[model samples]
Target: MISQSLTLTWRSLVPLKNSPGQLLAMLIQPVFMIVIFVYLFGGAAGGDRAEAVQYMLPGVLVQVALMATIGTGMNLATDIGNGVFDRFRTMPIARMAPLAGRILADLCTMTVTLAMAVLVGYLVGFRVTTSPLEALAGLGLVLLFTMALSWASAWIGVIAKSVTAMQGISTAVLLPLTFGSSAFIPATDLPGWLTAWMSVNPVSHLAAALRGFTVGGLDAADVWITLGWTAALLAVFVPLALRAYNRRVR
Candidate 1:
């Protein structure tokens, strides 16, 4: 199963060689977000430009990580819509290989996006005040969360009627989660009702955990909360995605 998944992962990635534009768009997305948020909205959001960069970069990383998962669903939906999954169904491979392969490919994409975000963040004056290990830990946490979310995305992709519907559903669900949380502004700065929601918001915890890891203050609580959320997402979504994949292929 592992070997089959790896091979299919390469298959998913091979198209990038012929689609330079797609790869270019992926590379450009993080850079664009960092510039737009750190330069244009930094002053208004964080008061000091340097402070804004530091505060916003971690949140931006979380945001970008979550947003990157949307593509997983869209790509899967595209494959299904185009009868690619039908071909997989007829192949003498593990039933889960196709889904696992797509997800592994997405992880590769998410890693690149995170690396790009971190590089762009450094170029824009966002410094990681913590040790190198902690910075890497922060990135790892984001990836872990992203992987869990990709399962949910894969389920959505499997069940969705079309690629357009998958895109729409993903955007609708994720936009509120990303923007409504502490990904942009501080949660305490929000209104009472919104603050209440942000208090329990998983994205808020994930962002806070990343900030804690990269910045000076490392809170065990934030890390724990983020892990709890990650585990919960995986528990709910993995079975759902696998079942959906089975049904779709059948």
Candidate 2:
């Protein structure tokens, strides 16, 4: 199973080789967006450039993490549409091989996005005040959350009618969850109703947890909340995605 999954992972990565433009864009987009947020709107958002980058970087990372998964469903849908799964079924690979491989491949891309975001954040005056270990833990939290959500995305990919439809549906769900969270602004700054919702938002907790890691000491409550959210996403989505994969293959 592991070898088969690895092989499929390599196969999944081949697209990156073929489409250099997409890979270049993937590396560039986060840097551009973070710079705009920090340099252009920094004063308006957080009163000063450095302060705004500090306040906004975590939220931006959370948003990027979520956005990174948006393409997972679309790619999975494309593979299914292209009859790739049919070919896979003929091989003696584990049932989950293709799905797991695709998820792992996406992780590679997410790693680049996260690393580049941090580098760019530093260039624009974002600093991590917490210990190095805590900063690492914060990045782990982002990866965990993204991996969990990507399973849900894989499920959507298998179930959606088309690749375009998959992208549309995933974007519709992610955009609101990201923008509505405490990522960009303080929850207190939002309206009461939205604030209440943001308090429960997984993105909000994840952002807060990350902010604590990068700009302040740990927040035990936020860490636990983010873990709970990650667990919930994985528990609910993993089985659903596997089931969807099974159905699609059949």
Candidate 3:
């Protein structure tokens, strides 16, 4: 049952046929952020182009993965809209397979996004002075957050009344989550109230964690803060998504 369900995921990747453009769309923002930050505002950031690139890279990478997950909900709505998931229910399959497969497929997309982002970062002079193992750890941290959000957003997809609602809801949430965090500039640059907000923003912690890792080692505080948010988000959303799926099947 599990094996066949896993096969469902691989088969779903078939969408990449006419969907190659989807992945390219995901790359656009990361690359744009890299270029604009390095070329336009690098001087104002009080650092070399490389330093500015490295700082902004994590923020954009997180944005890439987080943005990339919007499709999870939209696709779920599409499946419902097109009657594809309904067809799957008539077949013998693992109860959780559809959602699981969707998440796996999205994870693969995230991997591709991550690779493209890092490549752009490197091209713009972001270099790792860390050990190979630490670099892997840094990459792993980003991937971890990516997958966690993917899983959480899948729930949003499942429960959304329509594809449009999912987009509106997710976008509304993402704007503050990105801009309210430390993505563009240090929290110190934020106003007093906003700086206070940044101190507690989960995305701020994530950006800090990724930034610290890029520089060579993990920040213990960043690790704990990110892990806490990941746990809380997963705990809240995964079951909600499962319950939504049950309703969907009914």
Query: Which ten contiguous residues of candidate 3 have the minimum total lDDT?
Result: 42-51
Question: Tens digits of per-residue lDDT for model 3 on 25-115?
Answer: 7667678867776678766454677667767777777777777788777877778778888888888886578877887887887788788
Per-residue accuracy of model 2 over 60-144 as CA lDDT, tens digit each: 8888889989788988999999999999999888998899899989988998999999998988888999899989999998999
Whichever of 2 and 3 has more lDDT, that candidate is 2
Model 1: CA > 4 A from native:
none
lDDT of 1 by residue, 1-250 (tens): 9999999999999998999899888888999999888888887567699999988899899999999999999999999889999998889999889989999998998898789888989988989899999999998999999999999999999999998899899999988898898877887787899999988889988998899889878789989988998999999998999999999889
Rank candidates by lDDT, best first: 1, 2, 3
Report the alpha-carbon TM-score of model 3 versus the true structure.
0.92
Pairs with steric clashes in candidate 1: none
Per-residue error at 226 for model 1, in Å? 1.1
lDDT, residue 188, model 1: 75
Q: What lDDT score goes with residue 14 in model 1?
A: 92
**TM-scores of the candidates in the order shown:** 0.97, 0.96, 0.92
Show the lowest summed lDDT stretch of 10 residues, model 1.
38-47
Clashing pairs in 3: 73-157
